[model samples]
Target chain A: MSHGYQAVGWSPFKKRYDLVLGGLLAGYLALFSLATLLLRPEITAETLLIRAFGTAALLLLHAVLAIGPLARLDGRFLPLLYNRRHLGVTMFLAALVHGALATFQFHALGDAPPLVSLLASNTRLDSLSQFPFQQLGLAALLILFLMAATSHDFWLAQLTAPVWKALHMGVYLAYALIVAHVALGALQDERSPLLAGALGAGVVAIAGLHLAAGRREAALDRERRAAGADGFVEVCGVDEIAEGRARVVTLGGERVAVFRYEGRLSALSNVCRHQNGPLGEGRIVDGCVTCPWHGYQYLPASGASPPPFSERVPTFRVRVVDRRVFVDPRPLPAGTPVAPAVVSESGGGG
Target chain B: MTPLDVATWIVRLAGAYAAAGLLFALLFLFVLRGVDRIDPSARAGSRGFRWIVLPGVAALWPLLLRRWLAGASEPPEESNAHRRAAAGGRG
Candidate 1:
C-alpha cells in the first residue's frame, strides 16, 4: 500500500517468517559442514564455507524462483509469496558471502585490482570447456544485488510496477548465468556425478513447475466467451460466484475478476496495482478485494484502493441477465466508480 | 585484440563507471535527498530506506539524474492491455 513509506513494515508474521528462514539457513550450513568434515576431513575451512554458502544460495534461489509459479498453481503457497522478497534479499546476502570469499581467495592477491583480476584472470572465450564461468557468476551476483537493493515498496512506487517488475525479471537471466556457471565451472572442476545430478534435478523441478503454471494461465486465457448485442461478454452465472468471491474470465484479451458481493456483481481488472498480482485469485476481505500477495485492498465497485491509499485498477461495467453475469469487455478508466449490477429473485435485468 | 585485452578494457571501463556512479549516488542520497525529488515516496523516508536504495540508485543514477534534471515529479502511469483498453476502445 502507498499509504506512507516506512523503513520496514515488520509484523509478528514477518518476524516469524524471517526466523524460519534464518533457522533453515543455519541448519543447512551445519548439516553441510558435518557432511563435508565426515567425507573430506582434509578440506580447508575457507573451501568449506565457500561451498556451503554457494550451494545454500543456489538452493534458496531455486525456492525463490519456484514460489511464484507454485503460488499460482496452489493457494497453499500464497503465504510464501507474501514475504518472498525477504528470502530473495537473504539469498543475495549468502551469494555475496560466497562471491566475496571466492574473490579474496582467487583474485585479491593479484597485482591488478580484484574485479579486474576476476574479469581478466581467464579470458578463454575461444574454448567452451575453458570458458570464464567466474565472470558469469559475477554478472549474476550484480543482478541479484540490484534486485535485493530495489526489493522495497519504495522502489516499486518510484520505478512504477511495470518498470520494477521488468528490472526484477533479471532474475531469470541471473538464474541462467548461474546454471552456466555451475555447469561449466564447478561441475567441470569437481567432476562429481552426485553434484551434477542434483543440479539437473533443480533445473528440471524449476522448469516443470513453471511450465505447469504457464499452461494453467494459457488455458484460462484461451477460454473465449462471446459478447451479446449489448457488448457485454457473459462470464458466469450468479450462483457460480460464491458470496464474497470472484469468477475470473478472459475478456477483451485480459483477465477480469467478476466479484459477487452483498447480492451484487462488480468486475475489475484481475491485475493488482502492486506487483500485478492475480486479483482474481484473491477473495474479498472486509468489504474490499484484498490482494493475496500484499493484502492491498480495493473497493470492488470503484476498483480504487480504500482512502489513504492511491492504488487503482481498471473497472468494467457488469450486469446480470437472467442470473448470468455479463461484463463489458471494454474496461472503464481506473478508479471509475460504476453502479453494481443487482441480482433479483426473478432474475430481472441487473 | 586477444580476449584478455578485451576483458581488461571492459573491466577498466566498468570500474571507472562504477566509481563515478558511487559519487553520484552519494550526491543523490545525502545532498540531493530534499531536492531532485522523483516522488513523495523518495521524500518520505529516513536513513534506513536511503541505505536500502543506495545500490539501486548507484546503478540507475543516470536515469535518476535525467529525471531529476528534467524536473520529473510523479511516477508515470504504466500502460498494459487493461490500461490500453480502458483509455479508449479495446485495440
Candidate 2:
C-alpha cells in the first residue's frame, strides 16, 4: 500500500475565507447590479462587468499578501495559512476575469488576433514613461499562472520541497510586477480615490506585518544570546549528575544544559530546534533529548536524529578536571558525533 | 443584452462562477488540509478582513478545478503512529 515516498496527498475539510469574501463580493455586486439595473438603466453591460471584475482582481491580490503576518501574530489566525493557496487561486481567477474582459472589450473586436494586439499595444519596451502598462499586467498574469500551475501537490512532489519552494518565491516577483502593473495601468488613468486607498492599504499592511515579525524574532534571538554561557563554567562533582537526566545551567548570555545519559556526560544547546523551546527543560529517552514543546528528539552524542526527521543542535566539549566538570564554551559543529565525558568510579586523585 | 453582449456576459458569468466556485471548493478541501499539515490551527477566513478574501477565492478555486481536472488530492501529513512504527516503535 506504499509507493516510494509518493508525497502525501491532502484533502482538507475546513472553514475558508472564500465564504466570507464570496458573500461580501457577491452581496456588493448583487446590490450594484440591481441598483444599476433599476436606477440608471443606461449603464453599459461591458462597463458594469469591467468595474466588477477589476475590483474583484484587486481585492484578491490584497488577500494573498496578508495571510502570513496575520498567522505569525495570532495563533487563532493559523487557519488563514492553510487556505492561503485557495486565497491565491481565487485572486488568480479574479485576475483572469479582468484579463479576459479587458481582452474582449478592448482587444478582441477591433484587433488583429488579440495576441498580436497585446504584443503590439505595449509597443514601447524601451521607454519607461511611455511603456505600455498592459504589458505589466500581462507579466503579472504570467507569474500568477506559473504559480497556479505549480500549486498542486503533484507538481510540488515532482519538484521536491526546495525546488517547489524556490519556484513559489516567485510570488514576490509577481507581487512587484502587479504593483508596477497597477501603478502604470490604473493609477495612471483613473486615479480613483477608493481604488488608490485600497491598494495603498494592502501594501502597507503586508510591509508592516513582515517588519513586526522580523523585530520579534530578533528580540528572541537577543534574549537567547544573553542567557548563554560565554566561556567555560564549572558544575557539580562528576558523580552528582544522574545517568539519563539533564540539568539546566545558566552561564552569562547562554542557557546550556548538561545531560548525563547512558553513562556518558554531554552538553547540548539549550534552544530546541522546533520553536526554540528550552531544550534543557526536556526529558531524555533512549540516549536522546526529547524537546518539551513538540517532542523533537535529538541524540545527545551528536544531536542528530534519524532520517526524515533529521535535526541537530550545537554540542559542547566537556571535561572533568580536578573532580569537577568543566565545559568549554566554544560549541562543536552541530550534529558532529562526539564522545560523552565519562567519570571513573575511583573519584578524584588524592 | 445584444447577441455579442450575451456571449460576453455568458463568458464573464461562467468565468466568475468558475473562479468563485473553484476557490471555495478548493479552499474547503486542499488548502485547508495544507493548513492542517503545516499547522492545524490555520483556517481560512478567520481574520474577517475583506482583503484576505480576494486571494482566497482567486487562488483556491483554480486549484480545486485543476485538482479535479488533474485528479490530484491535497498533500497529507505523516501519521504519528505510522511514523513511529517506521522509526522502530520508539516514543
Q: TM-score for each prediction?
A: 0.95, 0.51
Interface RMSD of the predictions, in order shown? 2.1, 15.2
Per-residue alpha-carbon lDDT of candidate 1 for residues A1-350, written as tens digits (9 for 90 to 100): 76446667798999999999999999999999999999999999999999999999999999999999999999999999999999999999999999999999899997877877888889788977899999999999999998998898877876778888999999999999999999988888785699999999999999999999999989999988888888988888888898888999988778899988887889999988788888988889999998889898999999999887888999999988788888889988999999999877565656
Q: Residues A154-174, candidate 2: write the lDDT tens digits.
A: 344334344556677787788
Cα shift from native, residue A310, model 2 (Å) = 11
User: Model 1: residues >4 Å from true position, as ranges?
Assistant: A345-349, B1-4, B34-36, B89-91
Best by TM-score: 1
RMSD of each: 1.9, 13.0
Instruction: Write down the C-alpha DockQ for each prediction.
Output: 0.58, 0.03
TM-score of chain A of 1: 0.97
